[model samples]
Target: MGSPSSLKLGVQICGVGYGWGEWRHPDVPADASISLNFYRQQAQLAEAGRLDFLFIADSLHIHEKSNPHYLNRFEPLTLLSALATVTEHIGLVATASVSYTEPFNLARQLASLDHLSGGRAGWNVVTSWLSGTADNFGKAEHPPHRVRYYMAREHLSVVKGLWDSWEDDAFVRDKPSGEFFLPSKLHRLDHNGEFFRVKGPLNIARSPQGQPVIFQGGTSVEGREFAAGHADVVFLNPESLTEAQWRYQDIKGRAACLGRNLQQVQVLANIRPVVGRTASEVEQRYQHICQFITLEDALVTLGRPFNDHDFSRYPLDEPFPDVGDLGREHLQGHSEHIKQVARDEKLTLRQTAWRFALPQREFTGTPEQLADRLEHWFQQGAADGFVINPWPGGLQHFVELVIPELQRRGLFRREYSGHTLRDHLQLSTPINRYAPRRELI
Candidate 1:
């Protein structure tokens, strides 16, 4: 919303990388996923690039066949908190699920992060999609897709209400008067809802930003509605520009219909760009990254969206097996998207497996070419910005190559102009709901 000429970018700081084969790349360390130093370095690198934020993705459940990076990775909030001290200005965004966490705990932890990071904190709200996650959380069954949304709405409502427990000037330490805080400035949430019943004030005071930014990344019908009604930012994973454009328009329209400010909401697409100086180098890098993924690994990876449906049992060359409603209960949108892709392309089971496993080539090209694609997306209103999910060594390439091109074209900022995440995004601080209209302390 600051300017149509520039873009906001965030780096996905996953150590082993987004692709299943990425850790096998020579530039990546096998244990980088768990290494604090590795994360520190990535955070510093992203900050140096003047990126908008650092996104740390998390999942509550993992099986033996899970992606190597997911199998061994730091928790999002813990990792981001560690990152906060080493880097300044770069927003720290952590993904946490509403289905498995208590509202008070989640609210307190995220508020703490906002305070620790000097207001550069964001929470990417997620409804846990894996059916197996229920086992970890001690639930008899995972909440249905619709039920998860209902719980998410209530959970988020309670969290926000708690976040507003104290006014900005609530704490006033006066020695002579022996006053620690203004009593009238402190308020209680006293929330009782369908999913959460939290009472009284939050333990922490209002953070520098007043409230930490809210991020929503669900793509289903319910997910989009949640984002439109509540999210400050929306994360998307569209397979093509056409899909991205449709989602972009749909989300903006939905928010508009709800009478929300269009500029207050931002849409970010997740792009894994395979970059190089030359076409030959780009192809080589792409192939090099692909070599590590075996057919078995692809099958296992494919099974994930289908609620761990065993794709191995079906013939590789045969048409994708019809497992109706297989993924509807879990990852409904994603599983459906995969099935649609398979149907549209008439791909074999093996083809569908590899298609999703390997990084999409829509963003594969030289620096200039990648810049062209990104600029197109921005100018055409397909996205407000992008969450750059790098392959092994890809972040460095993007930072060094594509970013420079964007800056030169006046499509990105060459330097930081502000400190807080809201400032970086040119968004105004939200007034506390509990604060009086014209009262000043």
Candidate 2:
């Protein structure tokens, strides 16, 4: 496997830092999640850095145990729409779920965002992981892990079909003939599947990219297949270089097996890099950040992947309990990883929770050191690019210090080459399915 010549960077724009204790930091505002001004600042900062995109992660359900950032945050598409007017040449990717929402509405909304942003929209397709999320959606019970993927596959097909409702040259406004749009160019998606039935013709015209880019984060067996088959971009979180390289190969190989272009399928790893000017300063910053992590909060945060399984119930000092198949129904891939790590290391309950609460040390260093690691990962085929974690102060440090280092090395772009998200990712524009077939006369 070969790596892309240049690295693509996407910043996760969130109000507070990513950790549970980050809100209590002196530099971070407690209300930053709800503040529009804070979000706008983050977006503009990412754009000024010549980064590829701004990613907004979201979920529908929350309880007292939810992380501070998730407890209060902007609805993704709404927030992205607002940010679209303020920024140019940056892709706006929103996380939305397929399990609860109707295909027609989602297709129309994402397509509208593409139009509003002049074609910089991307949808990070997700199947809601939190079990309590079913309550808000009025479902009797949460769908099983396998069932969710099945539903997602059908939902995506319906949405894509709706996006093709109008051909590219369908609308020709002519005052002389009083013609608005050619009737032959309009098509309806009469879709019936195991999960959802959507009859369309999306009301709006096709967006600038034909269809907004499809982003998927799938780590499980079924998920990997779904992502490899359909997604234009895949987001991942691997704890080590070996794991990263393995995942990168697996995803690219899967796409190849499906007769998909490897280049069109981009894999991005999520990284939270904590940087400082000097080695001492870096250690000081790392320690200062570590102070904010309370043991109680870490336990709560750690429970999320297991469908909020209360780790509090287990003895803090005892070996991590074996709850057989406990999280099989929710966040299957993540929960299993946590269990495997706990077993391998023989960590206690508290140790396991704390391990996940803190950011990995591989990404924490001086700016030059951080740049070298990123360059190494890029050249070694561990990732095509990286999604920077949203930690306000750390984000500022990275853009100010590390971005220039990478740019100087010719490892990242100094300016955006095109207007659309597809352009940044180097993906081709899709042909309209309903366009008329040309004939030789």
Candidate 3:
């Protein structure tokens, strides 16, 4: 078994937090979603706990029925840039869609972030899932799953090429010589692919960590392949321990098959913990949060991946509606997952909706108990780490209660040991593409 110190942890600074009913909680501040101070505090707290990174999830477009955080929130890169000044050790990860954004612009922004944050920036690569997103982007319809994934591969290739535009010692800035940069070190990326044609070097110089770390989230065949080839960390939402273990093996195996070191790619699963000091307290807190979800809220929550297909039109008692091919084009992975759950559970429309509103899987119990479960998962090869979606008041509980327990058990770090995000994750600094390759005589 690997040492506990090997685990990589991250916290989701998801606007207003993760729970659907979080905003309705009286204890939670009303303006948390829009408040920079809220995010600042969260980032600082995560850093104090020695968490690896703070993840910010984003979407291109939102519907009226969208979640509170999704409806209104700061753009991820912009917000993370502000956070960069306030945080030092913890990594800053933000999601951006390859479908909607241009390669050059995003590459420049992320490289700048990596430079600004001293190499603590990570980009979560995503092909936008929402159907309505196309309308906003001046498209009649969303690209099909295969096409989107194809574009994503080409997009990432271009971005990576641009990131390697300059070598490590490219900018010498020799005062006496009056040479601002070494001309020989500069490299041009003349990328001409099916999806995009990007020519020449990037505007920014090489980042401190070589380039920003790449994070990806998806479970489809193409998604897994993409992650295996490019992603440093793969965010997952496994339903069970067995499933998590299987996925961990599958992804690692795929990467290994592709001639990548298995250790290079870390699989981090998303978990929402409803923790407390005692069983009674945990139950009380869980019930309190669950009470905030109304039927309307549940319907809206379930309808999101289905392209906002209104479930309210159907009778609650009836079996789940056949939303055949409704959002298959837009949100293929998510829509399929939802349908699989409904089929497996034999759930009605109301049941499925409520399931989304009130998630069933939660790490509930004392700090010790939660720590035990986490250690079990780590030892069992279920996960490399967790992308924790802290429940209402859960952030405080995690840092103060859970973190101490994990550290005491030798499962988590008490203080950061390295500066760069890559260093923290035990990943080696990437070699510059323009660096001359040594050949054996």
So what's the TM-score on candidate 2? 0.97
RMSD in order of candidates:
1.6, 2.0, 2.0
Candidate 2 lDDT by residue in tens digits, 1-441: 112587888988767766677889887889989988888988999999988889998889988777788889999999999999999989999999998899999999999999999999999999988888999988999999999999999999999999989998889988799999999889988898899877788899989988999999889888889999999999989999999999999999999999999989999999988899999988888888888988998998888888888889889999999989988888888889999999999999999998998767999898799999998998899999999995548878999999999999988888877889988888889888656353222
Pick by lDDT: 1 or 2, better one = 1
In candidate 1, where is summed lDDT lowest over 10 consecutive residues?
432-441
Q: Please write out the lDDT profile of model 3 over residues 352-375, one tens digit for every residue.
A: 888777845447778888888888
What local lDDT does model 1 show for residue 268? Answer: 94
For lDDT, the strongest prediction is: 1
For all candidates, the clash counts are 0, 0, 0
Write one digit per residue (lDDT tens) for candidate 1, span 1-441.
335457989988887876566687889999999999999988998988889999999898888777889988999999889999998899999999999999999999999999999999999999988888999978999899999999999999899888988889889999899999998878888888788889969989999988888999888899899999999999999888889999999999999999999888999999999999999999999898889888898898888878888899999999888989898878778888999999999999999998988868899999999999999998888999999998888889999999999989888988888889998887779888868653654
